[model samples]
Target: MPKRLRLTRRFPVAMTNDAYRRLQSFAREAELTQDEALTFLFEHFNSVTNHENLTARLRLFRAELEARKA
Candidate 1:
């Protein structure tokens, strides 16, 4: 069987050393790339939380930060 192609984009993020290490461990255990691990986490979190509200709040917070920087 042929492998399916997946389109992806680069998304750089900052994290604490401990968090980074934990994510690395998770990826290794799941046999996935860090990106895949992050995607899994995000989807799980969304399912457990109010995803739309969280996304709106995050967008607003980012906009405020950018406005302050400007």
Candidate 2:
């Protein structure tokens, strides 16, 4: 039998409208709830992308943080 993964944590999050919209869109397209989508992303994060590409994107996102918040 396969082990079941249970979602038992609850937390508060504040996101920019754009970020929230992106998450909503992703969840909708993937046919998963937002919580499940988030869980899946974090769980598979390591295998999901090229590390160098992710790092580059992270740096670019950091630079855009101020503008994104405005």
Q: Pick the candidate with the highest lDDT.
A: 2
For model 1, residues 1-70, the per-residue Cα lDDT tens digits are 9655363766779875887999999999999998888877775885756878988988997889867567
Error of 1 at 58 (Å): 14
RMSD to the true structure for each prediction, in A, is 5.7, 1.7
Q: Candidate 2: global Cα-lDDT?
A: 0.92
Query: How well does candidate 2 score on lDDT at residue 20?
Result: 96
Pairs of colliding residues, candidate 2: none
Clashes of each: 0, 0
Off by over 4 Å in 1: 1-7, 47-70
Q: What is the lDDT of residue 47 in candidate 2?
A: 92
Cα-based TM-score, every candidate:
0.52, 0.79
lDDT of 2 by residue, 1-70 (tens): 9768799998999987888999999999999999998998988999987999999999999999899779
